[model samples]
Target: MINQIYRLVSPGRFEITYRDMSLNGNKLVVRPKYLSVCAADQRYYQGRREASILQKKLPMALIHEGIGEVVFDPTNEFEIGQAVVMVPNTPTESDEVVEENYLPSSNFRSSGYDGFTQDYVFLNRDRVVPLFTELNNHTASFLELVSVSIHAIRRFKEKTHKRKETLGIWGDGNLGYITALLLRKMYPESTIVVFGKNDYKLDYFTFVDKKVLINDIPQDLNIDHAFECVGGRGSESAVDQIINCINPMGSVSLLGVSEEPIEVNTRLVLEKGLTLFGSSRSGTVDFQDAVNFLQQNKEVIDYLSQLVTNVIDVYSIKDIDSAFEEDLVSSWGKTVMEWKI
Candidate 1:
C-alpha cells in the first residue's frame, strides 16, 4: 500500500512524503477522519523547541490526537467502516507494574516517527477503540488527551488518601477544564475550585464549584488534592501554589509538560507529606476507559463540544498549514481539522 503522509519538514513548512506499506501484517489501516491540534503540535509547528530537538523530530507527521475510520482490517477484529479513536502510544515491552505509557521503550506518535497525518494510519490491533454514534467526532478527535486525563485521575485515585473533599485544579486551559469537569462528574460531592490568572479563560469553567484568580486565592482556602494543569513556565508557580494551599498529606497530580526542569519546594513538599505523581501519554487501556466513560456519560459529549474552537476542512497541504496557523492565534479550545486530505 502506498500511503501519503503530510510531514513537517521544517518550521512552518509541510511536505508530502510517500511510503510503501504492507497490508499483510497484523496491523489494520485506518483513514483519519478528524484530527485535533495540540499545544505540543504548535510548539513543533512554530519551532519553539530547542534547535537540536526540532532537528531530530521534524520531517515527521504532526498529529497524534485523531479519530479514524477502519478501511482495512487484516486482523479481522474491527469492522470495515467502523469509527474509532486511535491510541498514539506504541509499546515494545510489557511490564508487570509500570503502564505502557511510562515504559521507556514505548514509541508515541508525533514525537519521533509518523503520526495520523498519513493517508491511512496503520495501527496495532489494540490501538483502536470504537466510538458510539452519540459522541461527537470533533470532541472524539482529542480522545488521546482525554485518555491522558483519565490516566492521571486513575493514578491519583490510587495514590491519594480516602478524602477527596476539596479538589483544586490549577490553570484554566483545556486540560484543566477537562480534568475539573471529569472530577465534577466523578466526585459529585466534592467542591472543585479552578485557579488561574485569566478571568476570561477561567470563566469558561462555569461548571466548577468555584473559580479563583491565582493571585487572589483566599488565604484560608485549602484543598485535599490538586492537579497542576499549567505547563511551561507557569508550572513552577502552579506547583508552588499547590504546595502552599494543599492540606497536609494531600496528593498532587502533575499533568503538565515542561520543556526544562523547574525548581520545586522540596522542603515544603516533604514537610507537608505530599505525594506528587506525574502522568503523560496513555496506553490502550486508558483509551478504552475513556471510551467507556464517554459512552456511559452521554452528557459529557455536550460539554466537550464547547472546546471545539475551529473545525477546518483540509483537502490539501495548504489547508493543513492554515489550520495550524489559525490554531496558533486562537485564545482558547482545540482546533480540529476535518481530514479530507
Candidate 2:
C-alpha cells in the first residue's frame, strides 16, 4: 500500500512524501488519531541536535507519541475502529534478562526510522495497546510520555534505597510534572517536592507536598530520593542539586534528554552514595501499565487533563508547521495535534 508520510527533510523543513507500506502477514494497519509533540521531536524539527546527528537522522518522520485507530487487522485481533496507542520501540533482538528498550538492536521510531507521521501505520499485533473510547485524544496522545515516567518509577523501585519518604523532582517541565504526579500516585505516603524556575509552571504542581524555586532552595533542605527531569545544559545543575540534597544511599532516576554530554559531580555522588539510573523510551508492557493506571486513577486523569494547553487540528502540512511553531514558543503544558489527515 502506498501511504503519504510527512518527513523532516532538513532543519525546520518538512516534506510530504509517498512510500510503499508492505502489509506483511500478522501485522495491523492503524490510522493515527492524535499525535503529541515531544521535546525530542522538537529537537529534530528545529535542527537543535548536533549537525552530524541531524544529518544522519533527517528525512525521517517526526512523531513517536501517538494514538491510532485500527483500520485493518488481518488476524482479527483488534476490533476495527478501536483506539490504540502505538508503541514506537521496535526490538530486532531480545535477551532473556534485558528488556526490549535496553537492547542495542532496538529500532525506535522518530529517531532513525519513520514514525507515526504517515497516513497509515503498520505494526505488529504486540506494538499497539487498546485505549478506552472515552479517553480524550489529548490525554491519549501523550500516553507514551506517561509510560516513560512509569517505566522510570518501576526501575526506581528495584533500587535498594535506605529511604523513600521524601522525593524531590527537579525541572518544572512536562516530564517533571508527569514524574512527580506518577510518584504521588504510586507512593501516597511519600512527600513529593518540585523544584523549577518558572513560577507559573510550578503553580500547576499544587498536588505536591511542596514547590520550591531552584534558586530559592534552602541550604538545609534535603530529600530521601530525587529525580532529575531537567535535561540539556540545565541537567548539570539539576544533577548537582540532586546529589547535594539527596540523602545518603538515595536513588535518583534520570529522565531528561541531552544532545551533548554534561558534567556530573561524581565526587558528591560517591560521598552521598547516590545510585543514579537513566530511563529512555518505554516498551509494550510499560504502555499497558500506563493505560491501566490512567483507567483506574480518575483523579490523575483529571489533573492530567489540565496539561493540554494547546490543541491544533492538522489537516494540511501548514497546520503541522503551525503546531510545531506554537509548541516551540508555548511557556507551559503540552501542545497536541489532532491528526485529521
Candidate 3:
C-alpha cells in the first residue's frame, strides 16, 4: 500500500511524499491518532537549528511524540485497533553495560529519520506499548516525553544516594513539570521544590511543596538532589545554580538538551564531590514503565491533562502547518494534533 508522509522540506513549509509499505512485512503498522508538538519540533519548524544541521536533516517527517492505533499486526502480538504509544528510539544492537537509548548505534525518529507524521507508522513489535483504556487520548499523545522523565528518574534513583529529604527541580516548563510530578509521587516523603524565572510559569506547579523564584532563592535553601530541565542558554546558569544549592555528595540529573556546550562549575563540583549524569532518549522498558505508572496512578492523568492547552484537528497539509504555527505561540501547555489527516 502507498503511504503518505507529511515532511518538512524547508523552514515553515511542509510537503507530502509517497512511499510503498508492505502489509506482509514483519513490522506492525499503526495509524497515528494523536500527535504532540514539542520544543525540538518547534526548533526545526522555525529554522532555529544550525544551517549545517538543517541542511543535513530536511524533508523529514516531524512528530515523534504520538499515540496510534494498530491497523495491522502480522504477528498478532497486538490486537487490531489497539491504542498504543509509539516508541521512537530504534536500537539495532544491544549492549550489556550501555542502555538502548545510550547506545551509539540507535536511530531515533524525528532526529534524522522519518517520524510519525505519515499516513501510517511502521514500527517494531517492541516499539509500541499498549495504552490503558482509561488513558485520555490527548494526554497519551505525549507519552514519549513522559517516558523520558521516567527514564531520567530511574537513572537518578540508581545513581543518587538514599538521602531523599528534599528534591529540587529547575525549569517550570513541560519537562520540569512532568519530572517534578513523577518525583513527587515516587518519593512521597521527600519535599518537592520547583524553581523558575517567571512567576506566571511557576504558577502551574501548585502541586509541588514549594515554588522558588530562581533569582530570589534563600541562601539557606538546599536540595538533596536536583533535576535540571532548563535547556538552551539557560542551562549554563541552571547547572551553576544546582551546583551551588545542592547538598554535598548530591547527584544531579541533566535532562535538558543544550544547543551549544554549556560551562559547568567544575571547581564547585569537585569541592562538593557532586555526581552529574545526563539522560537523553528512552527505550521500550522506559515506555512500559511510563504506561504502567500512569495506569496504576490514574489521578496523575488529572494533573497531566492540564498540560494540554491546544488540540487541533488535522485533515490536510494546511492543517498540519497550522498545528505547528499555533504550537509555536502556545505559552505553558502542550499542543496536540488530532491526526485525522
Candidate 4:
C-alpha cells in the first residue's frame, strides 16, 4: 500500500509524498482521527530550533500527539473501528535500571522519524494504546502530553522528599495547568500553588490552593517542593525563584523544553540540598497510566477539556499550515486538529 505522508522538507515548508507500506505480518494499522499541535511541533514548523538540529531532523513527519482508529489488526488485539492513542516513543533496546524513554536507542516519532501525519500508520501492537469510548477526540489527541506529566509526577513521587504539604508549580502555560491538576488529583491533601505571569491564564487554575504572580510573590511564602514548567528564556528566573522559595532538601521536577542552555544557581541548589530531575518523552506504561487516570477521575476530563481553545479541521496540506499558524498566535489553550484527510 502507498501511504500519503506529509513531511516538513524545511522550515516553513511541507510536502505530501507517497511511500510504500508493507503490511506483511503487521499486527495493527491505524488511521489518524485527531491531532494536537505541541510547542515542540510549533518550534519545528517555525524554525525556532537550532539550525544544526533542524538540518538533521527536517523532512520528517511533524506530529507525535495524535489519536487514531484501528483500520486493520491481524491478531484482533483491538476492534476494527476502535479508537486508540498512538505512542510515539519507540524503543528498540532497554536496560533494567534505565527506562525506555531514557534509553539512547529509543526512536521517538516526529523527532527522528515519521510521525502520525501519514494517511495510515503501521505499528506494532505495543505502540498503540486503547482509549475509552467516551473520551473526547480533542482530549485524547493530546494524551501524549498528559502521559508526560504523569511520568514526571511518578518520578517526583519516587525521588522527592517525603514532605508534601505544599507543592509549587511555576509557569501558567498549558503544561503548568496540567501538572497542577495532576498534583491535586494524585495528592489531594497537599496544597498546590501555581506561579505565573498571566492573570487571565492563572484565573483558570481556581482548583489550585493559590495562584501568585511570579513578580509579586510574598517573601514569606515557601513551598516544600516545586515543579519548574517554565522553559526557554524565562527558565533562569523561574529556576532561581524555585531555588529560593523551596524548602531545604526539596526536589524539583523540570518539565519544560529549553531551546538554549540557561544558567542555574548551582550554589543555591547545593546550599539548599535540592535534588533536581528532568523528565522528557514518556513510554507505553506512562501512556496507559494517563488513560487510566483520566478514566478513573472523571472530573479531570471536564477540567482538561478547558485547555482546548481552538479546534481546526485539516483536510489538506494547506490546512495543516493554517493550524500551525493559528496555534502560534493563540495566547493560551491547545490547538487541536480534526484530521479529515
Task: Write the residue-wise lDDT of candidate 4 on 89-152 in tens digits.
Answer: 9899879999999999989998978988889998879998899977888988999989999999
Decide which is better by lDDT, 1 or 3: 3
Worst 10-residue lDDT window for candidate 1 reads 71-80
* All candidates: TM-score: 0.99, 0.98, 0.99, 0.98
Q: Which ten residues in a row have the lowest lDDT in candidate 4?
A: 19-28
lDDT: which candidate is best?
3
| Model 1: per-residue Cα lDDT over 1-341, one tens digit each | 79999999998999999999998879989999999999998899999999999988888999999999999987678899999999999999899998899898999899997889989999888888999999989999999989999999999989999999999999899999999999999999999999998999987888899999999989999999999999999999999999999999999999999998999999999999999989888999999999999899988878888999999999999999999999998999999999998
The local lDDT score (0 to 100) that residue 127 gets in candidate 3 is: 94
User: What lDDT does model 1 reach?
Assistant: 0.93
Cα error, candidate 3, residue 316 (Å):
0.9
Predictions in order: lDDT: 0.93, 0.91, 0.94, 0.92
Ranking by lDDT: 3, 1, 4, 2
lDDT by residue (203-307, candidate 2, tens digit) is: 999889999999999999989988999998899889888888988988888988876788889998888777888998899999999999988987798788888
Per-candidate clash tally: 0, 0, 0, 0
| Regions of candidate 1 where Cα sits further than 4 Å from its true position | none
